[model samples]
Target chain A: MNHLASQLVLVPVILPLLGAGLCLAFGRSARAQRIISIVTLSIVVVAAGALLWRADQFGPQAVNVGGWPAELGISLVADRLSALLLVVSTVVTLSVLLYSFGQGIVEFGRDTPLSVFHPTFLVLSAGVSAAFLSADLFNLFVGFEILLAASYVLITLGGTEARVRAGTIYVIVSLISSVLFLISIAAVYAATGTVNLAALPERIAALPEPLQLVLQLMLLLTFSIKAAVFPLSAWLPDSYPTAPAPVTAVFAGLLTKVGIYAIIRVQTTVFPDQPLRTLLLCAAILTMVVGILGAVAQSDIKRLLSFTLVSHIGYMLFGIALATEAGYAGAIFYVVHHITVQTALFLVAGLIEYRTGTTQLDRLGGLARAAPVLAVLFFVPAMNLAGIPPFSGFLGKLALIQAGTESGDWLAYSGVGAGLAVSLLTLYAVAKAWNRAFWQPRDEHVDDDVPSTGALHPGQNTVTEDKVLRLPRGMALPTLALVAFSVALTVAAGPLIGVSQRAADELVERTPYIDAVLGDVP
Target chain B: MSVDLALIIAIGVLVACGTTLVLERSLTRILVGFVLLGNGVNLFFIVASGPPGAAPIVGASDERMADPLPQAMALTAIVITLGVTAFGLALAYRTWQLEGHDDVQDDVEDALVIRRAERDDTSASFDEVDESLPEEEGADLPAVDDEVTRENDEDHESPDDGDPR
Candidate 1:
């Protein structure tokens, strides 16, 4: 019952906001902005770690902002689930900020005026943290708005035609989803007379079955589009790959995962009965099959990775679709693993783009000979993404498949089948990229736009040849650090999965979360 | 009841028009459609208040006061919509300035991907369309051409030199 421990939930959100404001105040000073952002994010990461530990020890913690009562004012709650996601996301963001520091220094001189990146990135961090910490539905929508606004700026950073075009499609899709979400919120409020998530379950359950189904379906559709589950995911591959590398990395890694997190939160809490489990299973199957099919068809590495990102979300949906404790546990584990692995892979992709001037599979070759460190960076995460054995990805997939088998339903079985197929195809896609980009001899027929002739012939031992493409230490170091973090997940799988199981238990039981916010309400 | 009915009908019309406009290829139309959709949702929120009555201000009399929560939510939604709409306009303007048209190009490869996915044919000729399309020179090249072109444009027009837009 330590007061400070109880109030620790707000630190993740407020620190980013304060940092964003400070960066804005220090406008046009790139050096100051970088120091403030990195320092602030590091502290936020520490705060999130403490919050997660406290939540684990004390069975979820809540604090009412401004001392207002729950259901009347905004409240921030840190259950094991939110705390876990907050820590992982801040770690990813902090690394990306460092990666961007490396990128900005290389693109503009050290004294240039690229001040917009810091504040906008901090705001995006705050919004994401707020979304995780929010205990109310309306506040979640506001969180989405803040993040989407920041992302719109980040995506179109240079205002080039391609970036602008991609930014427009992304904004329109996101705005449509936000509107649908707003309408659903209105519908929920009209039916339940409140938006407090903790107070939602009993009230939502009290509604007529058909109305409940409609309301649940509306919310599902909104989250589905945001999560980029099949049929609704057409915008993602086209939208994400066009941004600057770090921007694309964060967007691919974190944004859709936020949607998945919300789905797990709402599905397990507000609609714990899971009336639409069968439909969810169907969406999971299609998301896997269609997404991977698209991935295998892609020639461009970024688009290929983007497609895999969409496909892997189906695995998480499979866990959620099961609605069992093991299912929740597997989904949570996959989320953490996917966030780090996907971000690391994208950072590697960025490095490849830095070296080769393109992510087109046809143009890249002999990177293994040219930059062995970069090849290892790509190969490890790519294998992890494909769920190779002894890696965290395989463990997470095994957990999910086991959960599906325990369910013993045909749909669950099919979902597990689709999961396996997707994993194999994922391996195929990554291997194809690896062979084409790293193994094959450099494509000498590549267009004149590529100026680097430093790529060596495969099997040639001239390792000390003059390398034309010099990787910035700032960029390469952060990429390697992220790769190390992904490796750490594999090494730490046992305790990590244990934490996920505890989180799943909290998610399934629902009482810890409810009581945290409502304080012993029957 | 009548007021709620009218509000509901207005929402339906706005949503219908908005969805239609959003489907168009033009960016400006999509922006307008977003505004209309926002308005429709805002009105729906107001209608959800149910039998609007006196202001929610605390007083001696106002037993049937409007819920006020939806109104507050609607006001916040309006501000958000305004900000997004302004940003959308700025993006549209920039797209127009750069590309000389505001039409949102349908993703060329998505349709191709879907077509390939449907046939489930051999993977050998899958990317035939992409390969056959005479690889546009510098297609995957980053920002260099655009930057150089922009610098030239700025040099020609001193009036627009200062604006980052």
Candidate 2:
């Protein structure tokens, strides 16, 4: 059973890669590619669930490739944090994949081959899984590179002028961060003699205080850029809104969160003593205030959501800065909640764009009357994102605010105040969007090019003489599924929070992870 | 650990030049800068591996052997840099094809903000109530002229003729 659990650690990372290979091989047949991706991801979801259960039941599970010792070769570890995030992220990825298929069939005819999309998407999934499971710093860097390479392809998939422009900024920023990360790794190895996560704590602790702070700051700087923390976040709203909706959805949901995950891992395990608490707290407050201000100023729904995405990251940063078990637990729970809600909101925005051919808020109106279903879909997640009671967002924020106030530091108290104000501001922003895009009467100046509403099934050809564009059932169902999943997170908050608390405890203790990786060596 | 002064100087020069090049608006220059920066970092990995010594393979050396790990890491970094360079060049080519040059343009929204501030206007999207008012009333009411003037000014300045959807 132990061996089996250990082997399961590799499945999430490997299966998507194999699926990507098959997807590329079967590129000419869209159906085959779709089937391969769906089946592979389904298996990954199940495997991740099993891994989570095993991790919760036992402890961290580790697998050393080629039977190499932990220090000598790559090791993949699935502790409670990793496995839980794996399950959530894979589920989100699968839903977005399905949503994109709906979009593809609608935009291009059903028979058109999406050869590049499927393969690149699967590779992206593989990279994300690899990053989550990797147990060493170098392996983590490789994981980031893999995902980033895939993202560059995905972001610029269409090669449109706007896409190419946005992709340039995204690519350049990411490359700079990667270079910085590589330099950090080289510096770390120069100082520590090892890059393995389990071995790093001891070595890093032995370094002089100034040296340790420098290394910590360097890593934090690299990750802050990736995570879209405040001063470094201007590129995100500018770039993310230009991608195709599904790409934007997944990137908004998962990519920055991966950076946050890395921050959690390194801060907790690699540097157990928190030295930069005040710095992180300031960043958290600034990110929240500045991000929401940007969100409130946006006229485009996609751009507004992107800014809000940046804002909500502050909440997670707030939790992490607290540096307590409760704080980590809240952050983990918030990560799960935010991923689902944010992705669902973006998917709904896609639907809005699909129906109206635009996301500009001023030109959009009466969606509640014209497409009541979309209104409901947008409403639920928007309210959830705003921390409305009875939703997962509120619960996650409650957990974070509770953790923050419990810390008793003035900075934390100020963070709690900023968090509360941001929640209200988020509510205002989304409410303004809701009123502009849905509740208000249809504007007479809205584009005449918008197609008349007609609901259509997946396989039907949407092209017609009158140019009626229908809401594809394929797209709506997957989005609905995601919204339902967010609600499920709220309904099942008790068990989920328990799991997160356990994960947070293990993260803070740090021994279970170190032992799982290197305990059996001698 | 013995460090090579020459290698350190080379790394410093490469990184400094790379940083300057990266700050340029031209995509081609930025790509070149990226490559130099990447190579500089890769050399740092080599320096981190310690003083030069024998090959780290069985039966290849009797003396102190060089660490193989940083070399492997450098190789991986080189491969990644190679991939990124290809992609960057392709992007630059695409930008040139599209716009007749590969220099990155200013963000459209930033330009819009500067335009708004020059006319002493707030965000166009913020005041929906003013927008909802009847056009004649918006024009006739002296109190609402500022809003109306701002809206008209935006319409004239906007490339899409007041609709950039």
Candidate 3:
């Protein structure tokens, strides 16, 4: 049973790798690929759940692969932080997969190549899991590359001019950032003599001040790019919308968190110092402001959602920057909430695209009257994202704010206040989406009674497009699952926060993580 | 550090090549730019760890003649770059197939929807803004095909019946 606990940490990563191989090896049949992919993901979700339970009981634990000692082998760890993330990722991946079932990104003249999508998505999921589990900087880099490599395929899956263009930029930025990460790791090893994250504190503490700052700054830049932080986020909006719905949903929910997770790991465990914390706070504020501003400016739902993803990252940064037990806990809880809510909203947007054949707000109207259930699904997450009371998003935001205030950091407090304000702004943007796409009156001229009218299906009255806007069940089920889980998050916020708080304490104390690396942290 | 010097030259070459690609109008060249940029950064990683040979892997000889950490990092970076380059090339090929050109500058304002939003600025301006899409960018996009089908259902069904392909 104790050994099973270690295996739990590897499941999310392993399942995806197996799924990718199954998809690639059995590449001839799309149906086989889809089934294999879904089954693997289901297993990962179960594993994530079990790991969460184990972490709940035993606290932060590390597993060395092949039974090698931690120092000599690759390691996968599940602390409160990683476990929470694992659960969130599992939920999001499941939703996106569900939404993509039966209705695989169908276009006019061409069919979406399912063979590529299934395998790449599996690789991506693997990468995301690897990022969460890694206890070493270099392995973390491999995870980033794996995640990025999978994304490049997913983003470029359509092989369209725009997707390609966007993918080009995405790859370039990723390349530059990754290189920077490599450089930072190298310097750290040269100065500190170890890249094992657990060993980093002692090694880093021994280094001279200026050198440490340089290495830390390098890592900061590297992760900022991955998280789509203010200056480094130019590639995101242009690229994300062009992929299939499932890909977008996963990217929205899972991808950026990996970057945020890396920042938390490095800053807290490796570089537990003051200067870095202050810098993170500054970056958080800027990311929030810039992201919301971008969201406010866009009328396209997908693009708007992308910007909101950026703004929400700021909230995570806030908790990480405070570097307090409470702050870290709040950040961890917020990550779980944000992933579920964000992915749900993106999937809902895909539903809208399925109906009206477009995501532009102008072309969409009176959909709430049409697609009430979808509206319900979308409304829950959108309102949650805006941080209205009772939803996980609000709880997460409140936790972060309370932690900031308690920490007696005026700058951080103001940033939290700004974050709250952005939550409202986020709400406003979400409301704008609701109003334009679901509440606005329909145009009479375009209602030429096209062949798409009449006869409600078992679950749809959403639109009057293409003979009933028939959304495959697979598409809606995954999204609904995510929404339900988000609702569960809201309901269970008390306990989840409690556990996260404990995890947060562990992070702040740094004894366990540091002891794991620096050998019992005498 | 001999490794540091090697890192500088390799990344320098990458940076220069990337800048040149960014300047080119041809999408293929621009893609090449991205590839160069990625490789250059890989060089930065190689340089960062005391040249490329410092093996940081545990127990691979305690003397630390080479760093496995950077090498491992570079392997990931290289694989990721390969994925990106593959996508970029496919996109470039698709663009050439569509507009009959490989240059990005020529396609800047090609989408009818966004152009109408920008130029008309009237009763339809809001409409254009409502759905601000440029043309579909790649050969494999569902939206492009969906939009084409929708437009065809409304107006002409197969505009590309006489397509060069």
Q: Looking at model 1 chain A, which ten-residue stretch has the lowest summed lDDT?
A: A448-457
| Cα lDDT tens digits for candidate 3, A1-522 | 765766677888887998899789999987798789889998898888888787778766667777777776677788878887888887788778767773564541165676777888888989998999899988898898889888877877667655665665665567667757766776676676567888777777787889888888888889989988777876777678767667788898988999999988888887777687777788888888888877776656888899899999999998888888888888899988999888888898888887676676656787888888878978888999999988999899999999889988688778878887898889878888887788876563332111111111223234345444556576778778888999999889889999889888777777776555434211
lDDT of each: 0.85, 0.88, 0.76
Candidate 1 wrong stretches, greater than 4 Å: A108-113, A444-467, A520-522, B1-3, B60-63, B111-165
**Chain B TM-score in each of the candidates:** 0.64, 0.75, 0.57
Residue-wise C-alpha lDDT for candidate 1, range A149-244, written one tens digit per residue: 999989888886667878889999999999999999998988888898999999998989999999999989998998999889888998998788
Candidate 3 ranges with C-alpha deviation above 4 Å: A105-110, A444-470, A517-522, B1-27, B30-84, B101-165
- The candidate scoring highest on DockQ is 2
True contacts kept of 2: 0.47
TM-score of 3: 0.83
lDDT of 1 by residue, B25-136 (tens): 8889998998999999998888777787888988946477888899999999999999989999999899889988989877654655555457764332122332222233
lDDT digits (tens) for residues B1-165 of candidate 3: 454665678788887888688667787887778778777767666665564343565677657476565566667767766766776677667768866987653212113324444664322212323333444556466644555444434344566653334
Which has the higher lDDT value, candidate number 1 or candidate number 2?
A: 2
lDDT of 2 by residue, A145-229 (tens): 9899999988887787777988999999999999999999999999998899999999999999999999999999988998999
For model 1, the DockQ equals 0.22
TM-score of each: 0.89, 0.91, 0.83
Candidate with more favorable, higher DockQ: 1 or 2:
2
